[model samples]
Target: MKRIPYMLLLASLLLNIYSAAVWGFACYAHSGVAERSTYYRQFTAGSDPRTFSVGAFTVTLLSLIVFIAAVRKLRGWYIAVAIVQALFALLYVWQLS
Candidate 1:
């Protein structure tokens, strides 16, 4: 069977990691302290912010693992992963906007 290209796998993995990090940061910064200013509010978390971030990180990691495993057996799945990565990138941009 033809193997998937290494560069595609690498690109997907990097994009997945980047998405997870961006999502995790958003999760971590969900809540804000009352005393802190708007600019500094996101940095402070009094309540449990880990719950969301950890969940996001775990889901992203698991998806990446599943994608890697599937891509090994079935070629061309990387295209799907790349599309997903692109969507994630778009989501990141949307967040910034």
Candidate 2:
């Protein structure tokens, strides 16, 4: 159906936003642990996971807005966006753990 692409795009948009939110929370939740552990501090030195998550969330949100506006023209690209969304979801989970 002609609506498939639109639906896929919508799904992608939601997935990205959801993943971004999860990462945002993980960022805050992990910050204390990262601060308390010498290993974590050294590993994450010069790079705060919380800040990184916020940046990722912002970028994903902006990308979602752009893709939503151009969904019709971007047809087949929806699959790629979906794939990226999946990867982001996985990354968010990984960050939490």
Highest lDDT: which candidate?
A: 2
Give the Cα lDDT of each candidate: 0.49, 0.54
**Model 1: lDDT of residue 49:** 31
TM-score of each: 0.35, 0.40
Error of 1 at 5 (Å): 6.4
lDDT string for model 1 (1-97, tens) is 2234445456555645654564456556645533223322343342233343343344444555555565645447666765665465455444444
> Over the stretch 1-97, how does candidate 2's per-residue lDDT look in tens digits?
5565456556656645654564455456566654434333343444465554455555555555555565655457665774675567456546645
Model 1 RMSD in angstroms: 10.2
User: What is the Å distance of residue 56 in model 1 from its true position?
Assistant: 17
Model 1 backbone overlap count: 0
